[model samples]
Target: MIAFLTSCQEELDLDNPNAFSLEELLQTADGFELLAVGVMDSYQKIPANEFLLIDLRSDDSRANAQNGVYPDVDAYNMDTNNGDAATYWSNNYATIFRANSIIDNRFLAPEEYQYTIGEAYFFRALCHFNLVRAYRNVPYLDKVIDINSNEASNYPQLPPSEVYEKIIQDFRTSIAFLNGGPQNRYRPSEGAAICLLAKAFLSQPNPNYTEAELLLASVIENKESFGYDLLTIDRDDAVNFLFDADPNDPTVNVLTTEEYRANQAITFAKIFGNEFTGEFSSDNLRLDGTFSNNEGLEINEEIIFSIPYEAINTDNVASSQSGLDDQVETDAEGFSNAMTASGPSNGVNVATLDLLSLMTPELQPVRFDGTFRSITVIADDILNDTFNSKYHLLGKPMGTIGLF
Candidate 1:
């Protein structure tokens, strides 16, 4: 029994070759890359509640009364107990936590992987910026906190003024660390960091217009180096469609011509890079498209950063069946499930009447049609109502405020 116990003790004392500590892993370049991807993944969840939290509270959009917690948000009567607000707050902090993990251990990464740390700083600054804009006073988390440690107490809620200072500092740090152009439009770049820093300067309590101007001027002057350009339609092409005509007449050449419809289709395709079909109608509602497929124009030079989602097929069966005959498939990440008028839970987000009035077809034809669509509902053999579409084409929501 003593010999067996000794042998067991010796085996227990031996180190397992397969085990790798986080600290040891972080010392390599690949670890930093992996952690940077995690920061982006956490950011993906931040946009799920963006329309509910931001746009619904504004005059440009309103929430459907039937959806959960959205009507309260649209009415401006939402309190601390709001579920959407809580989820937004939690998602932002979760992203900050992942970013902090990379930032805190940045020193361990090799020289080539330093840009990943820069990306982390950019994301951390972005989350804090959004939090401060939405909730005003927020905790600025600069480092990863241990549950058993006193680090939680170290970061208390700070005033917007102090939080802006930290945000500016982080953006500057990110700019200093990042180099060259973006690897792709989906990843962070030095130019993006610079542009964000300039915006931060303007967004703070005391605006620094001069500094912001200088930063923006540098970016504009070096725009070609960063592969940035404006996506514009030719003046002649727009002039061919926009003229003084009775837009309601389907027989009118300007409104009903194939040339005009083709131009609108091309404009939509350029902006969204999605498949589209055009039609001429009496009400001047003509364009239809789905934002599911990409036509390579999705990653144009104008885009600084964006989130990409591909259609995923998933089983829709409620219970297991003995054969494949009972299986049904559906798009797991389809925009139709969340934003389309034909969606199961439609009207979750729709344009306010005021916004729709300002974007009439006669006044702003291209802008109006590109931003919104109208769906006519028929009931009892008559047209019941026409509803404005949601901003479904604005893929992967970005942080924006009314003041900005």
Candidate 2:
């Protein structure tokens, strides 16, 4: 019986043909590309709690008094126990770990994948940049920390100055490795690296204004080569909608209400693209409608880099309170509640009174209307009016979009 059991154990010890070691998998360009994609996937979580840390503390925005978690943030009294702060810290480090994997193993990859290494450096720098800015003294993690070793202790929290130095160096390396323009706006590029480097220079303890200026100038001078430009609308073409009056006629000095709306609609389409609706109706009334949850103005030349999100079904959205030991699902395919929350009463982030005072239709006609809409509520014979920012709109799961 003992000899038979020994033979069975020996048979089970044979290598599983289906399994591949990390070393074997990473011996090709495709493997490096896969790692780079993993880095991006990790980065998708970094922005999840940014609104709580940055916007809520700023004067332009505030937290809903109703949302218990963020009122401390809005009051500038958030503590170490804050969940949002903890989440932000973890998300950044998670992204850094994935990025470091590609960066540390770059030499093993083919020369053709150097651009992917550059992207890894860019992501690593970005994570550290955000960390130092938010937490001041933070560990500048360049390589993945081993769980069984003293690697974590080797990277003690460094001063903001030292952290900035590492961030700047990583950005410089990224710029050197990245070549040409961006093939995909969703990915990093040489231009993106240069811009980020310039921003880092300005953001550090001692701002290097001269270097930043030169870098920005180079970007502006070579904007066409980088495939970047402001989205523009032809004024003459817009004026042609003026009541069918000769657009070239000098006597047509005034625009009728319908003509004015048509001109505004033209401008809106140019900026937001035709994917958006609900601007104006046949009766010249503004309708409440959701923007298309697809790649619309996101592809505009003005966009430098943007994180993309799909409009996933509400049922697929992950719960925030899943068990720690269990696999905590994330809304990786959809927008977070920060941008898609229903309204001021139910949402955590909202425009402050100070910002709302300046966002009136009279003060900012096109800009205000495009970004915000007002809603009034009545309770107990009292009327309450609130201006819901575009981010607060319901059924809109559009992800974060960044413009130059």
Candidate 3:
């Protein structure tokens, strides 16, 4: 019987040579920093860049002019192998697992690195919140995972209601530690946690609106202290950045070497432009590049929390897994960049007529005195007898690549 049982199962050594033990990592300053980096990397990989999955699921977007585009998700076809579902499940779990590893190792961290624990709590809550939103149920993994245990693979999912309790708890833990952090906008801040926790409160089945309101009010009322505010762009720079009065201007057709240099490190370019392209135009918001450079842009007052995705050779921080692979194609890159006028440029998703018209006439939303913030980026679609107005095209890529 023992032989039979032994024969039924295969065993393999599962030691990870590259991994550091909790004790080993906290022994030095560099080790703690490495642990912090692990948390950030895990978060960055969470498939948040896939807008087709998220937007197609909503009425806000549809496939391109091509027929049967992203049809499974567009049609709400939740099949067993739904790519979006699988992506969310796998990515969220990976983030949760990383966060759990950090939480599990918190005791081993030196006092100076205690903020790493807080960051893990926030990431854990964020990942769980994403899963619950997508699936309405998930294996809320608050405990450290044992790779050797069969139960790890066969873990059960919790209903969102129960999972939410854990989410709240995690956020509270995050806020408690992060509230006393260095106040870095790139990482989780006390205000960011409060904002997210408030959002979590609102997302509940029986939403705690009172708490949400209080949390939101605290951020808004003390915006300066909370490290949040709208960016006040110079009038001429804002206009020059986004629009071309004359779309036929040859000089504006492609981004010149000078123009690219000016916008290279700017958030406007990082989010809207593709890397290493002479493809800058006033009408086309590709001045920065297709995959927006999100590194230092995180601290921009306009941003709350951002996932950083840099191109090759653009290491804003000293980390190994910090850049994106090239996804070059004949006309289109591998990913979608919607920060341009759809018909005239290589924008994949265009604003639907339903949305554009709603924003026009009396229904127009407010914009700054001399800014393109609320202006519609319309592209003429002669084939469809309608104009495609791209709405809010900035910051198309990223969802926190940092694992810590």
Q: How close is every model to the real structure, measured as TM-score?
A: 0.75, 0.78, 0.67
- The count of backbone overlaps in candidate 3 is 24
Mark the regions of model 3 whose C-alpha exceeds 4 Å error after superposition. Answer: 1-23, 48-50, 65-69, 231-299, 312-348, 365-396, 400-404
Q: In what order do the candidates fall by lDDT, top score first?
A: 2, 1, 3
Candidate 2 residue spans exceeding 4 A from truth: 1-21, 239-241, 244-294, 315-329, 332-337, 341-345, 378-401
Put down candidate 2 lDDT per residue, 97-199, tens digits, no spaces.
8898888888887877888899999999998998998889999888878856787756689999999999999999998889763556678888888888999
Q: Would you list the C-alpha lDDT of every candidate in the order shown?
A: 0.65, 0.65, 0.57
- Cα-based lDDT at residue 51, candidate 2: 66
Between which residue pairs do clashes occur in model 2? Answer: none
Residue 333 in model 1: shift from native, Å?
Answer: 5.5
Summed over model 2, clashes come to 0
Best by TM-score: 2
Model 1 worst lDDT window (10 residues): 324-333
lDDT of 1 by residue, 13-104 (tens): 77877865567668654888888888877776676666666666888766566777667878988887877688788889998999999898
TM-score of 2: 0.78
